[model samples]
Target: MPASDDVVSHRAGLLRAPDGEALPQRVVASWQRSADYGVDLETVEPVFSGTPVTDSLFAECGQEVLSGLHRTLENEPISLMLTDADGLVLGRLSGDTSLLRALDAVHLAPGFAFSEREAGTNGLGLALADRVPSVVRAEEHYSLSLCTYTCAAVPVLDPVSGRLEGAVNITTWSRSNSDLLLALAQSAASNTSALMLARSQGRRPRPAPRGEVVRVESARLEPGSGTAHELGEAWSDAVGRAAHALAAGRVVAAVGEAGSGRATLLAQALRRARPHDRILSAAAPPPADVETWLALWAPEVGKPHTGVIVRDVDVLPAWSAPALRSLLVGRPSGAGPVGGAVVGLGGGRPGGTTAGDHPASGAGWAVTAESANALPAELAPLVDVVVEVAPLRDRVEDVMRLAEHVAHRARGRAIEFTPTARRALESCPWPGNVEQLVRAVRHAVSRTNVVDVAHLPAEVLSGSSRALTRIEAFERDEIVRCLTRPGATMKDAAAELGMSRATVYRKLGYYDLQVLRD
Candidate 1:
């Protein structure tokens, strides 16, 4: 049954539902989150973020999807909207004058932030919040002012990387019958992601004329088993593959998303092959300094026993590629040294052997990129092998291990995280990858002794949809152990942990655990 306005008001006034009635669990969670965000229930005064959506890939693709959907519903009293991942409205399309006025009156037009943090619990906000399809109708909305409308929304993710890009939202009058709103929103969101993926796959990066270069300091050995063998099978497999390539003196490229430690993986492989190898790491330079940058690093490439790793070679300028290619593999077919005094030679070989004469010859060469296909066209032909580093999200088993490693190194002691805290860390999509995880762990350790869920940053608690981690399993086990004790009641178990009965019930549902009761 639909909740009445009076019931919603009563529930909003107190954090509890009216007698003989129950609110949706998701709605309850959103209400708690909205209250945490300090949203005003009496009005929906969304803040204007003033962020433009021009030329944004998400906005572009989303607009195309929404436009087609809008045409199908042009005569209907509906508004189709697109918002960035942050819930800042990017575009809104509606032919119905009444719906437009209503949306405008609530500041739901473009440039306004209707995120849960800004406009309380609504369809788009909840979809973005949970990275799922959501529906909020009439009195189910947290804000009283939104009680006159129904909204359904679905989060759009990057098809290639599974990163949250934005959302597709559909809004209509509260009295309207729109059972298919959620399905429509889901289809639109999927189409947007598919378009983005297609465009990304079809686009080829063109190298420009200029670029800059800077030498990177020695790689910091990460905490715990910085050695590849111990991190997990994924890391081990990548390092092993790169090591094989380096051992044969093949030009290798470590390809994966940024912050997935591609360069580090290559460096570790190189070190494994030649313990005393001197590795020179350089960030692909800016356009203006391509020539000088080439000149500066050309000598190091020719030095014996030295390995060279160019980070993000995918960004190398078009003009720089031929020169760099020449430096790494000698002069291009007919051309003389591409850069001044930058002749390609058999340098960096062990035992002073000519690199051309043997398989295990020449200075070790490697590069890093977001993907192998993203590398510059000029250098692509020279790459003999490509090693892929899996992102941290795919390496769930390594998250807790890595977190403990980071916390241990930072605090100089083993810091334990509560199971709930571990669940938060493990479930995060980790868009920033390992680098973000390190920062989050450091942030938690700096503030608290034993890391609890409360100590985790806000970002860690949201935007994740992965299955339960080992830590969450532990949490579930503890809950079952507590609940199954002889002659125990749910209230007693909640009291034992100093948790409210409501929280226990929420966790039970979250874990999909059923209580055996008399």
Candidate 2:
């Protein structure tokens, strides 16, 4: 465990004996278990006869992560490992062909089992066994063949189930910097988990020939490649930060325009952070007392981390606003956060309209809802923190990704978007945000074989600047120009506009510009 490679290697070797005091107690126990399992330190690389249970979304997403990590590993003597819950090496990506060939000689490829029970004391194996991020260097590995390597690994948990799915690991020569190795592993694992969570939430790409591939995209996607998972980078980051606060029992305030998925984000994060707690969902109402609201869960619900979610605080009455605000924002600095309540103040209405009348206590954390980017002074005092749930227009890549994800769920097959379809989608403002996208995709899927321009809702296409033909806009513009010019005569305008007087009159009439035509 010493910082020096030589010292750490010596310690690892010492751990091989019964009297080794250098290893952590848990690690020593793992080594003893490995020995009891009759592990062969010389040549124990277990190969699987069939596919692993992790071959589903977890494996797909893991491969996607490893493939992205290859950019860092390209032509280097390093390998990124994607192992299943059982510690099987389900996917491997490395740009160093020579190094990959060397690993293959040792059976460290796909379908190989490198579990703690199988490979013994390796980073990926121990990470799975211990359900924690880990690092293992030269000689730490119980297998002698792996003594020349250093590995850093972090477990990938199912976003919904919150169970071990697999691990993302970086493996390199023992000389590699352990800090950087662990950092990269943690980052990759987090990205993979976020993507996997999206896929689990019915956001799968159209099933590919091989099935749902959840690769983290590092660049703009090439033509014909579908984006697998997205909610925008900012939203994903916000979710992580908010979830972290929730884990520490902080009251989270989620602010977004109506239909932007503020409630969904809060709910999912709550479930993830406190899986055992009961979720008491409610729309903002004129509650008589804040204490009664907090303790309203059914008796059958058994958990210490239970909390309430005020779905739309914008709807709360003026009488209740002060009480709710005091409950969330009026506590003293030493007071505890709301019993884990995550209040989402809905947007669009004047700030004074929702949770406005409460006197500021300057004590607790509050979530300020910014529906129209306006933090009303009345409700402003209610927030200690503000998290914006970005609307769909701001994240167009996520639009296409979501469209494909929803389309697949509706159609039960893989479907690609046409360039025009994608363009139209990107241009739309998505006034209803995610809710609108869902309805629109469901509508398109129900009626069409493919999601094309024609299949898209007329309203969405109308909102898309590119959806209109050049000629259509040009004609409309020309008619408006000639008709609206100061004191312009229709007769002169028609001649210059290249239309007969009668045709110009008719066109103006058709466009409801008769008032201007005269």
Candidate 3:
């Protein structure tokens, strides 16, 4: 019997037997019997409804079940009907026109009770009564209005407590029948119940924090997901190792040479990490939630700055110390300061003066010879960390080799660089100093291109000589280029040309570069 509070006044002509006989008496008798069984009949005025036992638990479970059901249907005309433990229709998913009409004929939408006592007998009602799976087809329903539909339903059991939580039923027109369909519905219901139980029992495992590991190679930054390349098995193995470390929660940082599969590795790592984890490349930063930052050190000092603006420091390696010191002291060998702050990266003492030693008086700050040298040092005292390029002997030699190769290939012809020239092309300390020599030889062999030294840009051929060659003209051109680029750096340009950054001061001394130096 329903609880007294669960009783409701029957809608005037809502119920009819299979013979079209009115069942008002039977409905009233059923309500009375439900009251006798401790069911609240009085609450039936609005219908028997109660809040879920836990916050959003029932709703979340329902949603999970519906998701699987939707996938199973896959655009097929299938309808899902959810009934409470008491066999009341709580929700329905259907797109079948005929099924909808049949359901409407019996007023069996949400809020309709299909309990054994109320609906006499049906898959939903009988299943609720017996607490088991059931199927009711045409002519099996005690109610005349429901005799045209077929439904396969199963009682959903809470895995942890082993209680009948609810029931899921798939309904269709009476004409449709397939054992496969029935089995699918039962499987979906079982899986949904398992999920609900797991959630209820708090059995879901918490995902571990991902490791902070990033590897980026010489791949050009792409607009989305960065650049991608095929990695050989060796690289792939390394990436897999990195991924395993990440999964185990380790901090790993890798420096990939250009042409390596660094970008692809990074992309894969990002994809594998939890949504909260981040993968940052030059082109993109991880989501805000991830505690990560990217440091970009350009080879050129005067090129326009992109991405985050960290502290700008002049990096002067030991090899270029004399030239750097000379430039700082105003002795220029033809090249002028490109513009921007120059932070001496490796020459400062371990605990030298802080970046704030001079206390930059303006928005931009420059790390003079007094600032720290290593990454930790520069990062320690500066608000925004930026690395300035300084040519080392190895680097200079490399650049010279590359330059000679380029010159030899041109054979003295006036050659035009497609993108003018790159800072790295101009200043990179070719670690494999003579690598470009081989490339040049190959290029000359393949294309029969004549090597031109004179046509080469003054910056590439003469290095600092270009700055001192025509100090005024160079300054004007540099200023115009900086203004055009919007965020050009003088220090960067100086480093690229293998010249002392102090030359910028001498050049600026002659002509205003219209740049705000910090």
- Backbone clashes per model, in order? 9, 2, 62
Candidate 3, 1-518: lDDT as tens digits: 34332323443245454458764332343333333334332222224344323223444576567766777575666677777776767777776677677676665667677675565546666555445466766544444456567777777755533335577777776677735546756886777775664554232222222322222222233211422223234444445554543443322222222212233443454344322333233322222212232213222222222111121112211112223222222233223222222222222322222322322111111221212333222223322222222222223333433344444444654333322233324342222223333343344334434333222222232222211323444554554344234344666666654556687655544443322222
Q: Which residue segments of model 3 deviate by more than 4 Å?
A: 1-56, 71-74, 203-518
In candidate 2, stretches whose alpha carbon ends up further than 4 angstroms from where it belongs are 1-21, 51-55, 202-518
Q: What are the per-residue Cα lDDT tens digits for candidate 1 across 1-518?
A: 23344544468555533333566566765775576567887898877878666476778889998999889899999999999878989899999998899899999999998988898889899887766678888877888899899999988866645456789999999876546888889899888976775665232122322433433334443111253346888888778877876887777778888778887788788877766656776765544465677787777666677777778776543335656666776655224222111111222322211333221225567888887667765566566677778999999988998899889889989999988778778887777788778888999999889997656654465442333444565565566556655577888989886789888787777765422221
Worst 10 residues of 2 by lDDT: 207-216
Per-residue lDDT of model 2, residues 1-518, tens digit only? 11233433455565552235466544554554456456775766675746655558777777787787787568877889888877778777777787788778767777888886677678887777656678887767777788777889898876643445788888888878888999999999988977775654232222111111111122222111232335678667766766665665455567776657676676556555655544544543222233344334223122234444555454332223434544444433223222222233332222221233322221112342444234322344334344677887777768887888889977888677767667767777876687788888888788777666556655455442222234554565576566544566778788779999899877655544423444
What value does the lDDT take at residue 354 in candidate 3? 33
Candidate 2 or 1, higher lDDT: 1
User: CA lDDT, every prediction?
Assistant: 0.71, 0.60, 0.42
Q: Between candidates 1 and 3, name the one with more favorable TM-score.
A: 1
- Candidate with best TM-score: 1
Tell me the deviation in Å of residue 492 in model 2.
46
Error of 2 at 281 (Å): 26
**Candidate 1: C-alpha lDDT:** 0.71
